[model samples]
Target: MTQGLAAAGCEVTLLLKAPVKTDRLVAPLTGVPGVTLRRPYEEELLPDLGPRGLTPDQAVGLITRLDTENRFDLVVVRGRRAAIAAAQAEALAGRLWTYLTDVPQNVAELTSAAVSELTDIAVASRFLLCQTEELRDFLESSVPAACGKSVLFPPVVVVPEGVAGSGTPHTPLKLVYTGKFAPRWNTLEMTELPAALAAQGVPAELHMIGDKIHRDSPDWAKRMAKALEDTPDLVWHGGQSRAEALRLSAQCDIGLSWRAPEMDASLELSTKVLELGALGLPVVLNRTPMHEELLGADYPLYAGEDIDSVADVLALAADPDVYRRAAERCAAASAKFTLDRAAERLRGYLDLAFPAAPAGTSPDRPLRVVVAGHDLKFFTRLADHLMSLPGLEVRLDEWEALRTHDQYRSKELAAWADVVICEWCGPNALFYAQHKRPGQRLLVRLHRFELYAEWPRKLDIDKVDAVICVSPYYADLTRERVGWPADKIVVLPNWVDDEQLDRPKLAGAEYTLGMIGIAPSRKRIDRGLDVLAALRRRDPRYTLVVKTKQPWDYWWIWNRPEEREYYERTYRRIQRSDLLADGVVFDPFGPDVATWLRRIGFVISTSDDESFHLAPAEGAASGGVPAVLAWPGADTIYSRRWVHEDTDAMADAIHRIVSEGRFDAARAAARAEITEHYALRRVCQLWTDLVVDGTAPERIQLDRFAAVGLG
Candidate 1:
């Protein structure tokens, strides 16, 4: 990755984990134009740390100190420990881009601890770097935080010059294997391939390059040592330079890479295979999914686990026609992983990660704006973001109740402000619509609750410049209900502060489901319970956590006989069912929802209808996957992937997501979808354009709105 970035003309400083003596330097990066190797910490700093090198806290301190001095645009760290350390440390929050190379090889190897660690890194980093598409998929599936953030930054295969295969097997066909002799890699097993091929009436020799050997088992090591010394057709060349390795490998008829089943299941592609293919040598490897994608299923050299399978494949490769076809296929496949291609990919990722600032200039004086609302809970972040803008001066006109406000203060602020924005289309909106002056712009945001009320009909439509709805579904509904002009209404989604909400998930969060606000009977607490019952039937670990005020707390709802009956019946059902009795938990409502969401893995929305249910969206922004019932107009507000038709489908989706080990990927997709459509920054831009320039949101195109009856 460093080489590819350097090749793209970036001045990259490569930080060594432990201090290395400058006198003993490798020749590979000696002349790289834009690369520098820096050992910031001295040997004395980590004297007794052994081969493990720096601990997470030690790494954090070292990186923090170095970052302060260098002021780096991006800090690229590799491995789980380094990424977790960087993510948890406030000093390296926004700039850390982790290259995740040391994760589990497959879903079976993906443990709960690994998932939690990766999730922490995913939420904190700018983006997660993947070496292959398979690895990217695996990472994204295991860690929800990695869904939209994971990007491909594959290994750069530098092909040596003047090395090419003959496209025909030699008289005594030579087979070669490069890289370490590890137990799982099956390097020791290659010693038997030549003799096995000879039994099939095909003469062959096995050649091995690399000095490193992982002596994992004493018995295997002893057998490997004896084979290297006594095997007639085997030649072991201990650790040669790249140039020497390629030159020696070029002399061979085929490259050998078949490994043990466990190693074959890995999501990573072999760089050595690409290197051999760059020399125009066909590779004989295990028939894994990644290998099939790389060389194609018809590449002719794929082998299974048994020695006979490898031997059979080697004998088949001895045929000139088969050898030439395999060689061509491998060379074509390897072309995509060249150093230059890697450099181009790196440049593209960098361009997106650090885009050029958009051109703009501030106004002569800040525009005076007043936001009037009875409850600004939904609009506080939007108000705060607007105030931070360069050319905006904002103030709030707080009301005592929905229909009651200080008349004198409202008039004074209205007269003083250039623009007045009524957050809800209630009495405040009516006052602004009736009193709007010639030079003043009055905008009313109509939520679903206000649409049900008489506020829209009572408002002076002629004086109001524009009415904003949280979704196009609501916008169309409002237009029909109020009989407003085609162009009088616009659609802008409710905002979610992604930076504030995208926090690390707590351990065991994947099994904990959450539901927010079930005040009215229509919010569908029963449906949520049904879904929870279904999930708990499959896995007892599944539990539902409800965060809301009790039904009795709402006077209007509790006073109704139907509401009381519904609660009584729901309580009786929970008492009867084993799944519901122990699985349901209700916590008191509080303002600290962001903190509360850390323990929730999935957020359920089983409402019969909604304006733009902000709870699920907020949960998504907090890295929790939303399992929503397909309520009326739900598709417009959320992606169809998140909306299930019934409780059964919702339960099925939640179960499949967890059982298939794609909870992270599913949650990430939800989070990315919500953040992209309704982030605070994007909504603020729309508001600024409307408040300052009197421009309609581009999404509210005249033709599209007219087609959808929102014109």
Candidate 2:
């Protein structure tokens, strides 16, 4: 990968954890053009962190020192510990591009610890390079933080030229295996292949390379040693260099990579198999999903765990026609991993990771902006983006509750700020407005819930410079309700982190309907139930998956008699209907909504009313089509096509989307819309203009098709 990046014109610095030996594989990369190798042990007099390897502290110190001196564009780490160390450094966390192969790669093996570990690194990284598509899919589905940031980056194969070969089948087919002889690798079991093939009336020679043996079991280790020494028609060459391995493999007709079932189910593709394929040799491997994707399901040489399956594949490989076809397929599959192709892929990924800034977009003088808020959930991502901007330094003054905060901290932050952004139009905004210093700018964002409270009425609008609203309708409403001037109101739509939300949907997601935040009785959980029943009546496969906290969990909402009664009635209706009862799944609320949305094909927003519903927009960002009911101002916020008149119409729209086999197309279009309008980049740019440039926020119109017929 280092060589490929260097070849792609990137100034690469390959940092080694320890000093390299003369015979090491990486020894050749030293002093290469466009590549500078750094051996930390040899360069710095560092204390020994632990036995035999670099510790996280050592890695952080080395990387920090190097970055200070050279100012690298990106820092790529290979393992979990290194990524964790880099993530700990606030200075370099945003620049990390992690390629972690050390974690559990398959869904079945993924544990909570692994997900937590991966999430920590993923939240801090600019990109993640996955070695296989299977691993990428697994990560995106299991780790919410890993969604949209991962890209496929399989092993690069540099095929040697002028290898000798013959199209005709040999009398005795030659089989070869190269790598460690571990129990799960089935290297010991592979020695029996020669005899198994001979018993099946197909003569074969088995060549085993590599000297690394895992003596996990004493008896098995002794048995393997005996097999290497005395097994007929089997030759053990121990271990050899890369060139020698290829030369030895090219001479053989077949490469043996079949392993035990545990290893067979791995999400990773064997590099040795691809190398052998690059040598123009057919490889006999397990029929894994990744292997099937590489060589196609019809590839002739797939083997199973048992010896009989091995013998059957070997017998088939003895035929010239079958051998020729397998060889051609292997060669074609391996072509994608060529060094030139890998270099091009690396360059393309770099372009995506760090897109060029627009011309003349120079940074302004440094600004210290303090984002003071009681509940900053909706604005946290915006704050993080602001911190990433070139000339801005942002800090958050988090409050204890909606109206409670540390007065000392809040006062200190307000006094020191060039601009103070009150996330919610509550006590934070009121306090900042009342305590504004001379030359200090104050901006307060008001959402739907804040308008109903007395805080906005009590807030002194004269002291505030601008009041931000999520929608134009809400902006006008806020101005009328709070008596703020039209010039003081700004309509900044809530942003969806499109990159974080967009991910590959799981199979059967097309039948799943999703609802987020069905609380307070006003969100209309009953209406969502009606839609689910309507859909299930047409097809029992349709199901509703609701992700939110139970209404009782919210004290204020549950305390209201109407809200409690509404939920009880809704539950009874669900329990009464057969189609609706078993078809609905209630998942507890959590932060991993990206992962949760993988199984959701449609986002249902059948609310009684909303100022600017964000769930459907989030769903659209995640490639799930939105089925929004025609609430007040719905057409202004969303395309008319997504806003249906009622639950029945919403159900019909969803059914039509599925029955016409246009679910993929519909979701693609929806995702494109979200990317164009509500994407984080566009909204971030608007916020940057408001905060840094002191540009007045405007009441912008959405739904470009509002004046036209339904689209």
Candidate 3:
């Protein structure tokens, strides 16, 4: 849990029984980032932090102070009175859980605390619920306060080495056991099975590798010695380190853990079963609902918890094919219990612990920010930036509702968030604007397409806190077209990450022209071809390159009746015109669009109207001199040199830049303009100030952003 959480951007602090002084012990953990290793109490204060060595008061006091100083989100503890201390530590921690072994005393102890406190509980298994009849009702009814808090939390294994098949033909079916040999485990019955198997002409060897029994079971040690002495084939290797034990187990065949059905400890999912299962060693254990859930009902090695049933496994292991199939099932079942995968399930177990921060609460907890929409291609950098902050948790669920418009699922997601920014002006914005839980701060960003869509006008503008626009042009257009409140709308220019886009252009790329989007008639594909024709007429080497999804693949355009004629004309022109047929190039849109954009000397934006014209901004960041056509709001966003009145003028400017050998200079100038106006950090800071600090967009002085200091 510590290793996985630390990797997932959580600041982890590991508390230990003793200070790790050895260099070899600490060296491996040195490079795990954002992890702090510390011991809360001195060794003298609590020698082993045991019930006898130190009082419960001392342990609780030390844990509570750690919670106070470090601000722990959850306090998870296991075994005896430590569970009691953890349940009481709920006062200081965000959430608390007592990981209990699935036994009668464990359930009773937690039930006593559940009535007094509100801590979550994670029991070992739901064994009683599935196997026992009357006890199932008693288990859930025992702790009324822990109705939804308790869960079956099984131990997860870290299967480092490859899992090997247990059965090897003519290898005496090397049976091994790694855990204790207690009477409750039916160790005497297990030990006698090897000799009985040898009498059946299926020779078997058993290796027992364990240190000691549980605290109260010292008598089982003497029983284990007598049983091993009686059996010639049973050998005791004593204790082995966990790593070496796992390695040694891989060499063995059938794993044995057949116990009586009445054994209380065996009722839960055993760690011993998992240990053998993870190593692909098929365990000969009793069949139960929990066992079936772990290894599936088809597991051939399951016995009736009897000595004769365990001896039956030797007959199967003697057969190469049947043993191989059973071994495969064990290996397959082990995959789900891996530490990393279990850590994800652990998140679900920990979810009920941390309650949702109430709306308008102080920054005492992480500000929950949820960015939800279909077209959130632009919000990734900002979302990532927010997550890296000290007191913020950002979740970007782009295209979450693409399969269905299920309102209930969307609301459940919205309840956890303090602020919800609907990226595109579509169904997500419409849904949140209508279903908003009153406390959530809703901000929806509208681009050009949504201005034409019906959902924008359908939005409940009253409930929306703000409408973010990539540029003032889009803000003005949406205000007039969609009739949204002018006061609520603000221009926060789309962020362009300059560092990732900038790259060296290919040799002889000074003559190549690039265009990003080529769909929707307003883009004027013919005009782009005309401009390219003029440039190509001057020099045949001048080619226009387009990188976007192929036109035929756009299902929405094909579905729209009005777009049919436009596409037909565009494709006909593209097929007939020599300049387009030969001089123009097209490639599918991919992750490396910046690399494709870098090969062009100039990027032309020929759209009739645009809110932000991200293609030209991205092209400028890619060190490509942008040749932007004059649109209604183009001049406000870009300089006059980039904006041209017509196709001929756009062609003339490109010609002038090439003729004067100013491609490098123009590229540098374009990059500098984008750097000054549309840098990622600079724009994200504007958004941070608006959503987090509640500073109005108009109040944000872009020139004085450096003075405000983003960090």
Candidate 4:
């Protein structure tokens, strides 16, 4: 939850009771990039804090001492005792934000006492809104205090971008469960699932990926160990970090998230469900209205009490097709709850409770803006627009010199600019983020590769005001991977120049298809070949035109043994399929991209994964109908009608555009989309509104792609 707030561009201070190391896995938040951990907070009250807790006077005195040394704009605390303590600290009235997860006993008293001090109350699940409505209404009617509220689930569980394990489930099925082994959680029944499945002639394995051995649970720990020993084929992986556990869960057949309703009657959320879904793994959880809200009412994999029930439901997963469908549903469900989206939603709630302090420079000076980055190609036109704007002085700084004799002069630049927009998540962003002066707003623009790289992990997200993503897909993944505030991350498409992209289409160009950036397997040129081969079988005039620096041109990309093997295999497939005969054409890298694109009437993006593919947009801008393969979030970036699922679909789209006398109209529609949605001036204006006018980034809308009289 703190990660969500930090990522939402909040200056977060994690007030730790004491710095104590234990058996638990290392927390990512222990020394997080943009958060401070304050300790030595009057620990004389620590032992009493557990059961007895502080009296109202003691609570007031304890907190007042802490505040006298370090003041706070807002204080957010959870739990019954903590909420009471914060409410009693009258010096900090009207800034205490209490986050409620479960409807505990005496919760009404807690809410009533905190009403005068609290800015708002928040719940972990939407179910709590209905459950706590009575308390909220009482506070409103009695105290006349505005009891604002919101729902925020745990931060989106990020699945590591590793090679996903693949193994078909056979006679012996594998299941995994993550979470504490509390008595009320029915851990004994969960661990007994495998033995029950085996008794039914279905050999099974239970991989428990959390600690059963805890200092707090000596008796339950011993019982859990004995249960594991008695139960056959059980692997107890003491404890693991969330990332390691999710990665391990990827290989399992089914996820176990069945929790006994010890609290809230299972109406609240189970993060284990989100973890499994993030890994694209199916889960067997107890059926509830909240589960239906998350995974839909018709979701097939439902379970009930006891071990046999869950085992029988997972037995259906023996069928490959059923397992595939279940996994698809899990992935689809998880996509809706990314950390970025959650953080963005949380920021809206926070705004109502505590409005953001205005961010600007003094009125005497012009709006000093500095645009610095490693890759400035995409920003060429946008930079021109920034310079043209009155009352703004924009300076461009290229960081290609960081690797060479040219040293980056970030200190001087940092001192001069009121707002700095770094073009890529490179050295420039890191430097400005670390050394940015007071009152200077910093924005770092990131594309696809940065999310996969280590730069995001090292970035000081607190210093950066915002990180602009080229597309929402990139923004979502980046928030999860980088742990940056989602509110601070804005989506702005790259400016497409009308002078460069809009051009005349050559005759016979309607049959030619163009694709760029082939090196690296992610480009999926092999998929492009599949589409090319399918199209050529229908008409030989269809040819694939690839413009790239040959596979071996960049040694850094092709020198890797795996990369070389993939490149050679792709060539082997091309030769075997006759794509090289008359079906495919390779053009060496050149400067005249618009001319090359104009020679082809259709374009294709066949990447397996992408943040944003410029080739399709450029091709569309150059008067070609872009048929993009559904990669990651391609459907969201490109119009759904232009995105294709596989080779057959892409080939069919190509054949339809050419054979139905729709080439002229389709080409015009594609160019019109680029002109309205991504044209240099329109995109530049959107940037200005976000940076200069203080408009919420989400409020700026782009034009839609629409074809006239096509129906």
Q: By TM-score, is 2 or 3 better? A: 2
> Which candidate number has the best lDDT?
2
**Candidate 4 minimal-lDDT segment of 10 residues:** 123-132
Worst 10 residues of 1 by lDDT: 702-711
lDDT of 2 by residue, 555-581 (tens): 999999988999999999889989888
Q: What is the TM-score of each candidate against the true structure?
A: 0.63, 0.84, 0.48, 0.47
Which segments of candidate 1 are over 4 A away from where they belong?
18-26, 40-59, 106-109, 361-450, 453-476, 480-488, 491-711
lDDT against the true structure, each candidate: 0.81, 0.83, 0.69, 0.69
Q: How many Å off is the CA of 15 in candidate 2?
A: 3.7
- Leading candidate by TM-score: 2
Candidate 2 similarity to native, TM-score? 0.84
Give each prediction's root-mean-square deviation over alpha carbons: 10.1, 4.4, 19.2, 22.6
> What RMSD value applies to candidate 1?
10.1
Worst 10 residues of 2 by lDDT: 702-711
lDDT order of candidates, best first? Answer: 2, 1, 4, 3
